[model samples]
Target chain A: MDRSEIENLIARVALKDRAAFDQLYDRVSAKLFGVCLRVLNKRAAAEDAMQDTFVKIWKNADRYSANGLSPMTWLITIARNTSIDRLRARKKGHQDIDTPGFELIAPGLNPEQAVVAASEASRLSGCLDTLEEDRGKAIRGAYLDGETYADLADRFGVPLNTMRTWLRRGLIALRECMSQ
Target chain B: MTEQTDIPRDDDVLAAELVLGLASDKDVIDGRRRMSTDAAFAGQVVFWQERLTAMTDGIDPVKPPARVKKKLLAQVFPKTRVSVLQRVWLWQGVSMASLLFAGYLGVQLLEMNTRPGTQPTVLAAQLVSDTSGLQVLAVVEPVKHEIALRRISGEVIPNRVFELWAILPDQAPVSLGVLPDSETVRVLVPEALRSQAAQFTLAISDEPIGGSPTGAPTGAVLAAGSMTEL
Candidate 1:
């Protein structure tokens, strides 16, 4: 749905319309759930947090103000906060969260992302190819593996500052490459 | 320093590094803050967001389970109304059902053509609940004949009722009537009422379970809005 449609529905939801609220859930739950999963790093916990976030949305719908932030931003704020809350609670000792192995946690894209990917694949592919092999590895490792610059530095037997420079230069090259 | 003020080159370097996931947590945090506050930084952010935004292309699309959506819907719309009293004054009143009616009322009152030609001439003041941020009271349309009072259904406190009142210039507030329900709530604007409305206000007061004990607004004013012509 478009921004206006989402905003309109949210306004209706503020008035306690069950149908509009359901429609909003149908539209944004997948992407929002993915965000929850990313932060909590577990499926079941993410699901729980997602449900809690929606409940908050339902109760607090009347509190939304269209000052500057978009509806997605507002919704994402709630989801992120909910996931963070659950994570904090888990840190205090809930062990039921099933964190998958790193290999099993394959980078998953949702539909909006898929469309963006489909449109920009060739350009990005060419850009990724232009970076030096090691530099590309450094960037990909830090990003996809969620590793730190120090980790990349240690993994590659390089100085931390040197690793940082490589990623920086690699990104510059990639930007230039993609624009071309 | 004077020769190095042209920082697009430096910005490009920083943005690319940030996008490549090379920036420190501090770097990322500071950069995002700057992006929001600085226009130059915002442009760089848009450029980087566009470039890195494409990386999702390599990932596979994952469809979550059907139960996920069902769970979400249930969470957002829990099937429960705690009261046997199926009727209450709606508080957060910006319903889509009412917006069209408001627009029509606006046209009939103003006689001024809207949209495609009309401009937002009036600063429409819908009385908002300061705590809940809900637009509870509003001047739906200020017509020569009538003014619609738009309010939602679940706004009334269990033991309270709402009574509408119109404040007049150089005069005390005038009691309109009790808000019976959500649907039929049009208040007649006394023909002489318009000239003074700009200087006056629309208000609602909480009354007894039925209505105001005193024929005037005896309880706390729930919501109020200033009237203006556009």
Candidate 2:
């Protein structure tokens, strides 16, 4: 579904139309589930997080229009933020010891290639590619894997301050590249 | 708009940090609070979120298990007005049947108490699978640290062992033990994990023989329910 269709459905969802809510779920649940799975990294927890995401969407659909975001953007923001909250909660409970690593399983292209395809993601991918490969991967890993700065630092074998500097500079470069 | 120039300002950097999930949880919470009051900062964060989310375009979409939608629907539109009326009517019918069953159970418990034969069940959970319509009723005797599991639904897959797990909130699943196949099986809960019985949820997973080799549930969670005081 395109942006307008999703927006209209969300508007109806805000009105408590059960049919529209079902349609919204049908259109977006798979993508949102993938987002949750990547962030939570556990099937059961990801499912729970996805369920909570929809509930939040149902409750907070009215907040969408004021955000000046595309419908999918708004929906994904909710999904990502909810998963991040779950990540933080899990971390607080000291449950990170057994987080199983998941393998990315897309059909045609490898993950990085697919990410850079000339489609909706092309502009962002091109901008990210301008950064050092490690820095770009750090940004992607932070967003996709819900890694903390500390976690990224450990993964990259860099000091925490150096990781932060790399990311800050990388974000600036990405912003500059997107503007062009 | 002036802040959109080549160099990102401090607030823009903060917004980027928050959007990237690299900020500490406290910082993120403060950032959200700032976004509520600071329009320009909020817009910057949304801009970053939209652009970064586009990068996820490559992630493949996997169809969630069928029960997810079913459970979501049940939660979302729990009982329509018409269904509420139907539920009331059904409850009235079931209440009579339940009363009779409760009376019969009372008599059986009284007999057991008088005979000093059976320990009273201290805790119980009815593990129901929304996907498969499987129900396993479990009753625990705290003093003995033993739980009796009875299969309320007879649907069982051959060669797949049913493993029971205890899941505390925000914690990884701790293996309780493998459950029996056909009849009621009384399994002992390990002493170290017994204190968690009251607060945690009991879930059953379909695992290979000898249960989960890694000390965690490796199979689909077939059924789960929270323990309740009995």
Candidate 3:
């Protein structure tokens, strides 16, 4: 995706320009739907999630540029978070993950310099593959499955604090591998 | 900077944990608040977000079924809905047929007007619409500013009421009132519209039991015609 092009569309959408919103949806909906499907797994549920994701995009577009993340990150993160919110709602007593405060930032500040170039970001999958067997699964399960530490501890049959420590260490190693 | 030791800083772990949603509810809430106030901590969170979001780069884009876009756009930009009666009146253009029908009713009414002077006593119109059997003959008593109506055809749809309206040129349809269940009914014209009564096109719409909640004609127009001088 052309980052600036997506950014430009978002800026227009912030102004409530319907044409730009339509263009932006055409440009990114396929990718966002893919992300929703990955997290939700059911076709109908994923479709619903995708709808909600766009509603949020239309409503929150004004808040986008102030958020420090890149445009695609802002969008995909919304799809991921919306699907996960729906997923958690299905189960009884599951803790609701609040939509993350991605918009919390000083106005006029852009994080373009801090953003990992798309090329280097692609190394993330390879980095995950290089991790010791269980570590990769743990990270993916937590990130994609919306599993909490308690859920992970039960799945891996470890103590709760142990799961936390394990995930913390796994993240550190994963970060190191990605940077390489 | 990469962590040189086995352990890393609390903010790094917190940011990563927060991104993956591994943080507890309380911690996540606090994390959100901190991200708003603490720019450095916010950048740490964004770094993980950018990296982790790339995990989906492998997920192939599936062109969604077309209905999704259709549904989305309808919700986003809804056009004012045109009712079946309005479509007949506006698009199928039964308005000309209505005028012809009104002229026929007018001639008959004129022959019956034996007790008249120069002043017109009764103005008449035949409310007719195509494709629906609904037809009405409206006799406007010009002096009293009242209209007496009798249904010629079509049944009052169950649970729906017929509402009378006076439509003037280039203006919205104004509600006269809901027609009673009986075939013959009388409706008083608003004093504001008394002068325009000579040039008025009266219409009836099928509305909810109490009539259109909004003042305008919200339901399907059953029948309509321009008043003819008798």
CA RMSD, predictions in order:
17.1, 19.4, 15.0
By the TM-score metric, which is better: model 2 or model 3?
3
TM-score of chain A of 1: 0.52
User: Which candidate number has the best DockQ?
Assistant: 3
The DockQ scores of all candidates, in the order shown, are 0.16, 0.16, 0.31
Give every collision pair in model 3: none
Give the Cα lDDT of each candidate. Answer: 0.57, 0.69, 0.76
Reference-based TM-score, model 2 = 0.56
- Tens digits of per-residue lDDT, candidate 3, A32-137, equal 9988899999988998888888888887887777444678888988989899989889778656564633544544235564445344477889988888878789
- Write model 2 residue lDDT over A82-137, tens digit each, in one string: 78778877555332211110000111223343333323244888778878999899
lDDT of 1 at B223: 78
Model no. 3, DockQ: 0.31
Inter-residue clash pairs, candidate 1: B89-B153, B89-B155, B90-B152, B90-B153, B90-B154, B90-B155, B91-B155
lDDT by residue (tens digit), candidate 1, B1-230:
12222223477676555544455456666666665566555445434544553443354333457887777665553323212111212322334323443453555533443435643223233554555332443443433345565553335654567777778766778877777645336776666765555666777788897677767788887777775443
Q: How far in Å is the alpha carbon of B199 misplaced in model 1?
A: 30
Better of 2 and 3 by DockQ: 3
Candidate 3 clash figure, as a count = 0
Tell me how candidate 1 scores on lDDT. 0.57
TM-score-superior candidate, 1 or 3? 3
